[model samples]
Target: DQQVKQNSPSLSVQEGRISILNCDYTNSMFDYFLWYKKYPAEGPTFLISISSIKDKNEDGRFTVFLNKSAKHLSLHIVPSQPGDSAVYFCAASDWGYQKVTFGTGTKLQVIP
Candidate 1:
């Protein structure tokens, strides 16, 4: 059973606009939410993350929000640029579990 899911397979956003990526999880044991960005022929790199204790976390242009009650999370990128285009994966894990479940991913295209 897939615990994490990204309903949208792809998303398109214009350059300089805001990009929103959504994720949903069914596992209540998950306590950490993470976002990873992957480019062609490259490994997925950690982008941003949010702990279950907090509702939101921001780093520069990237922000992640966790809604525990809704079992959902979202990543927001403001002033989206072409370079930001990538396949974003939403991952979740429980504290000390050292195991993470990832969503299939959402391909984001930032059009210039």
Candidate 2:
């Protein structure tokens, strides 16, 4: 069983458009949710994060929203740029647990 899931395998968006990526999780014990972006041959880089106490977090062009009751979250990029294209992963962890689970990544292509 998947503790974290990203239903969409890929997404394409035009430059300057909005891109939305979805994620769902089965574990309610998860207290911290994070998003990471990875490029080929490179390690994943942390993008944004939200603690269970918050519903939303935003930084510049990236925004992450969490709906705890539904065990769902989404990452949104406004005016996406070509350089923003990457594989995005959703991760979750419980503060008391040693394991951090990651969802299957969603490949994003921002067409210029």
Candidate 3:
């Protein structure tokens, strides 16, 4: 079974608006969560992350929120830009575990 899952396959948002992406995990052992953005012909680029101890972490226009009890996490992008269009992946890793599980990914498009 997959440890992490992204129910939404894609998302569309107007430029200068907010884009929200969601992810869910079944493993409670996961202590760290990360969001990666991938462009075509390129590998995923690490965006932001949150620790289990923190409910929210923000970096500039990107923010990631984690809900431990709900086994869920979400990413918020404010003032979405056309350049931000890409496939977003959610990843989770346990404190003592070496393997990081990634979600299926959600393709986001920022319409001009």
Candidate 4:
């Protein structure tokens, strides 16, 4: 089965602090990973991605780490701001497969 799990449905953090979201997958054939950030009433937007060949990828305030051996991944946001509150989704896909399996989602609440 292709099941990507985001165990925590919600998380809260104060402004200017770090926020972390976790995800786990059961499928071992997945070769590429991606993270998306979605705001209310809008489609998910690509944030960062990592290849199965790489362990970590970072973009400015956001960082994603993939552990292929453990079949786990995490997204880290440094000094999260109030504007950063939104739902985050972890997605995975096999090489050459356009279809991506997404985690349920994790809502991040940033306190002002």
- Taken over the whole model, the C-alpha lDDT of each candidate is 0.97, 0.96, 0.96, 0.94
Give the per-residue lDDT of model 1 (tens digit) for 36-73: 99999999999999999999999999999999999999
Clashes of each: 0, 0, 0, 0
Clashes of 3: 0
- Model 3's lDDT to the true fold? 0.96
Higher-scoring candidate on lDDT, 3 or 4: 3
Name the candidate, 2 or 3, with the larger TM-score value: 3
Query: How high is the lDDT of residue 42 in model 1?
Result: 100
Which regions of candidate 4 deviate over 4 angstroms?
Answer: none
User: How big is the positional error of residue 49 in model 3, measured in Å on the Cα after superposition?
Assistant: 0.6
Say which prediction, candidate 1 or candidate 4, comes out ahead on TM-score: 1
Model 3 over residues 3-111: C-alpha lDDT tens digits?
A: 9999999999999999999999998889999999999999999999998999999999999999888999999999899999999999999867757899999999999
Please give me the total number of clashing residue pairs in predicted model 4.
0
Candidate 4 weakest ten by summed lDDT: 92-101
Tens digit per residue, CA lDDT, model 4, 1-112: 5489999999999999999999999998889999999999999999999999999999999999999889999999998999989999999998787679999999999999
TM-scores, each model vs. reference = 0.99, 0.97, 0.98, 0.96
